[model samples]
Target: METTQPSGTTKRRVELRITRPTLTWFARPTVTIDGVGHPAQWGTGTWAVPDEGGTRIGVYLYNRVWRFGTATRTVTAADVSLVYRSGPLPVGAGRLDAA
Candidate 1:
């Protein structure tokens, strides 16, 4: 969906679907867009897109001791759907792709 921001600039949104295996130990996922952090839960979530194209997105699971299962991607489509799938091992990079 798209909405107008207070600055009169039009902003868009992208749907983010996140999932992980059973061994995350209750650590939450953080979705970072354009260097800003946003707390995310499992399943579907939405993030506001400040720019329509060339938006940077990153996802990682923080277990307090280490930050792993990290993924990053750049989006250029007007309507986009992203998914983050954690790796089997917690110390590896996660899969992030368009869905």
Candidate 2:
């Protein structure tokens, strides 16, 4: 469900598909929308964001040692579906693509 902002505007949401080659993760993933961090799980999730253009979406996995599998994308008003694929290795950045 969409949330109502203090200004009474319904917050926009986007569908995020998160996946990694590994079976498990020590810590949950984080979805950062416009710099705000939201905890997320694997598979599919819906995240609330501002209802405006030029929104930046970022996803990353945080292990106990360090944060990796990072990716970022700038979405427009009509953009919604997104998929974040973690890199095979834990050191480099991942891929974020429109789905």
Candidate 3:
């Protein structure tokens, strides 16, 4: 990602799209030098993403774990719009403003 610069701030802006997916299963940390997947429990971690064998990844910092894998999830402003459009849980009739 390029740092924002005054000269081309608007032109080179990255449309960062973030989609808050459903809370996934608690992932157990694992490691595989070769092509294998192992499950780590409670307090273990390795560099691996959700998928892609070995590419994209998410670092579980608070949990104190870091992983590396190939599974890049792109989020966009539009996506956020869609998610909120449905409104917060407890199921509403879908509104821009909900009390």
Candidate 4:
């Protein structure tokens, strides 16, 4: 007799890439998916999302020197690549846009 594997055993992978502007300073960026945080170092990476949907992606930039200053953005399922640019103040010093 022949046996077949279950379809649910397969996993889907999503590729994520991030770029940072040259003028950013004293800020550390991180990417969050489904409330899980991942390093946002300038490069390429991969992540796994739920098969049934309902995934939230966010980019946060933390300013070490400033205690109350941080930048964050959360969105639904969308493009995987993002670009980080410099903003005006420390609270909004970093910005993430679809790349």
How high is the CA lDDT of each candidate model? 0.84, 0.82, 0.25, 0.57
Clashes of 2: 0
Q: Pick the candidate with the highest TM-score.
A: 1
TM-score of each: 0.85, 0.84, 0.21, 0.57
Candidate 2, 75-98: lDDT as tens digits: 888888999998766777888899
Q: Write the per-residue lDDT of candidate 3 for residues 22-76, one digit (tens) a residue.
A: 3323322232223344343332222322222222212120123433222222323
By how many angstroms RMSD does model 3 differ from the true structure? Answer: 14.8
Select the stronger candidate by lDDT from 2 and 3.
2
What's the TM for model 4?
0.57
Superposed model 2: Cα runs more than 4 Å off: 1-4, 23-27
Judging by lDDT against the true structure, name the best candidate: 1
lDDT, model 1: 0.84
Rank all candidate structures by their lDDT, best first, as comma-separated numbers. Answer: 1, 2, 4, 3
